[model samples]
Target: MATDPYADPKLEGVSIRSLPKVSLHDHLDGALRPQTIIELADEIGLDVPSTDAEELADWFEDQSDSGSLVEYLKTFDLTTAVMQSADGLRRVAKEFVEDLAADGVIYGEVRWAPEQHLGGGLSLEEAVEAVQEGIEEGEDAVDRSGRDIRVGQLITAMRHADRSLEIARLAVAFRGRGAVGFDIAGAEDGFPPSRHRAAFDYLASEFFPVTVHAGEAAGLDSIRSAILDGRALRLGHGVRIAEDLEVVQQQGDSVLVTFGDLARWVRDREIPLELSPSSNLQTGAIAAWGKNLEDHPFDLLYQLGFAVTVNVDNRTMSRTSLTRELALLAETFDYRLEDLEAFQLNAAAGAFLSVEEREELIELIGEGFDA
Candidate 1:
């Protein structure tokens, strides 16, 4: 029972780190420990910015705070570079689960593009197999430690790439193995989900679950395509869906707002928004609102009854964990423990799991919060 390094001071006499959480948008490549990157790079002859993990961690944070989605994405080059082998992918994935468990995550969905990891002469199937092996190993390790955690894969396809159809097939092929859903990530501005319609169509035909990276780097149009074309069950960092809302008036905690068709539909439909406050600030997703965490539309979305689930889109890059994210939001929005519980319950309801499994997660979250 090692103490969680990311634990925040108790809020309402409850340690945020000890609460059950469901991570819906965590990325495998983006969640690697800085020290692991150093050792992995050493093995593969890859050069990193700094051998010192602390310095490398700072470097990631500095680089990610560039306030441009494209600029923020450049940091992934180093992370993805080290994940180009079976062993590297396996190790990273294993540690990813272990770290989540340490942070009190009851369940998580680790997203990564298999196509990006093929540089080590491993095929798509091999890369997935390696990651699955790592996830299982991590889960077993967690069980042995007197804790329980389950993780699933969200096999991602790079939006700018032409092999989404191939990647989609790979995701569906891994169903019941490790993969639980599909997503199209990277460069969401120009490479709309419509561009990957063929893949989405195929996934839809198979009744496979889908989530798309939209409304973060882009706006309403991107979100529209994600739902209409990509058929996303959830929006990855869909914070910008706020752009569709026009604040007509405001007074203290009360405000009058007008929602456009897109925003209205998304909210009314209860399509979960995987809103990562830190990552949104770092990547300029909420630049239109303001430059600080309080400026995020997360509170607004939640108040408006949208299924707002907090997440750490990239743990290492943002230097964040779910606990830290929750602490920040609670501090900023003056949220109570029940608000935190609501977010976790939203995430559980939106998980890419069967109704029974989702209910179980919901029950676990409720019990943990009650304790």
Candidate 2:
């Protein structure tokens, strides 16, 4: 691994970032370009921390690294403020795809709470439509540039809000449009997924896919509720699932561990853990295990046959990309090309797309890796 953390390394003479990838846990508000934030803030009369894009970028990195989820979320206040208007949503979505394309992401699902964007007098339907339009525009722009990319919207509900039922409907209503799944995201500790049973029930009834934010702020109980009550097909940042595993022994490179029933089920079922290395460290999601990237349970879960996928949960806040996250893990875990490919395959398998679409993504990844 290179000392330059952000450098794209060549594994077998192929750049890691150039390899085709799939993004499942990325947040729309979290992936914004710094320049776009300034422009959007100006349009909405919002005061940002800095007018210069580079300064704004550093500001985000500093605040998120402050080790407070509350402060981390305050950054979204400015992002969502600008995203209230249809045009803002569209531009952001478009640029979101472009950024992913530049990072060699072939497929991505952008998740955000639509209910939060209704403050600018936009209806739930209109907000979703605006995002969808931007996604399409972004895809078109990529195609015109001779690079291919496809993105889906994961309509999200804020867990602290009582309008999950409405958001669930909003997600299901746009099923074939741009929306691919439903999720609940917010302060995860207090607002367990059980609180949104009505929304999850409705989503289940409609056969909509769900991914819940769990185990990042709380523990096994929250993850249990996410899977049992929320019917989550995937975990938003379920890094804390490692808590369910009891280390029995360690001898040099080998260790014996036993998994609790919850961890066993999640691993056996291959439920994807969207492990954002940097975000998990900053947010204290992996505090139980350790405070550094090496302390992250990503390698433990991966080595134990758990479905672990690398991700950038909040790109701006974490000052990261899918490539950077993978690079960090490779540096920490001494991973190679095969290890990186396995993560991409796991993410493709966990994507909210239909099995057929997921298969297509898998093929793209295989081809890219082979190249």
Candidate 3:
């Protein structure tokens, strides 16, 4: 077994990084480049911790690993500060997709709250358009490089705010233009999805796909509201749903577990768990289980038949990639290539893409694994 967590391990003589992957819970503002942040900050007359790219990267890693949500969120304050301008948002979005493409991601959904970008005086529509322009540029760049990538926007609303209804409308309006889904983020503890009922009701009427950030900063009640009120097609993190499970007995490799109603509903319905292993550990989302990856309950979730998908929620903050996430899981659980492929299949099935497009993704994943 490899002692290095970041090193890629061969799964049947094929590197996991080379496998086609789908990212369902990655954040846009959370994946900024260090050099880009320094330059953008300079242009806007804002101060940054380090002007040198490498040092700035180290600064981010240190702050995020500080074990404080407040400290971790301060990094985004710097990133979003630079993203207040149209050019900045466009450049960041473009580079975001390009980086993912280089990292071997074939399909990804970049989620960010547009309401956070309007401090620069751009309307939500203009902000959305700027991001769309950048996404198209990145897609074109990937195509020119003989690689193909497709990324969609998951327009997000801040759960602590009251603009979800408007944000939902914006997301649905741009459905075909780049936006594929709706989500609510920020301060998941006090603000449950019930606060955004109007928005959820409107989205349900419009048939827009929704995902809510639950089970990270809160518990089962929050997740219940996310489903009942937000009509979430997917649960962001959703790790706490495991709390509802009662492990009755353990017999070596086999155990008898009883599930609560919510747990049963989510599992039986195959609602995807957008689990970001490293991020969950950093945010203390899985702290109840244990501190290390081995204690994550991720293996249990997988074995229990949850549609669990691996992700890097924030690459910059987590100092991780999809490859690193998979590598860590494999090292912890001794998973094989088939286990990794199962996660990809779950993500492909849960993607907001049409049935035909999703089938194409499934076929592509199967082919990649076969090769």
Q: For each candidate in the order shown, give its overall lDDT on alpha carbons.
A: 0.94, 0.89, 0.91
Candidate 2 vs candidate 3, lDDT winner: 3
Query: Which of 1 and 3 is the better model by lDDT?
Result: 1
lDDT of 1: 0.94
Best by lDDT: 1
Error of 2 at 29 (Å): 0.9
Clash pairs for candidate 2: none
lDDT per residue (tens digit) for residues 1-371 in model 2: 21555767665667878989889999998989999999989877789999999889888888888666766788788778888889999999999999999989999999998888888899999999999999999999999999999999999999998999999998898999989999999898789999999999999999999999999989999999999999999999898899999889989889899999999999999999988889988888887777888888888899899999988998888888888888778778889898999999999999988899889989989998987
Q: Which portions of model 1 show Cα errors greater than 4 Å? A: 1-6
Q: Which lDDT tens digits does candidate 3 get at residues 1-371?
A: 22554656576688887899999999999999989999999998999998988788788888887544556677798889999989999999999999888777899999999999999899999999999999999999999999989999999999989999999999999999999999999978889999999999999999999999998879999999999999899999999899999889988879789999999999999999999988888878887888888989898889999999999999888878898899889888989999999999999999999999999999999998998
RMSD in Å for all candidates: 1.9, 1.9, 2.1
Taking all chains together, the TM-score of candidate 3 against the true structure is: 0.97
Q: List TM-scores for all candidates, in order.
A: 0.98, 0.97, 0.97
**Model 2 bad stretches (over 4 Å):** 1-7
Q: What value does the lDDT take at residue 123 in candidate 3? A: 99
**Worst ten-residue run, lDDT, model 1?**
1-10
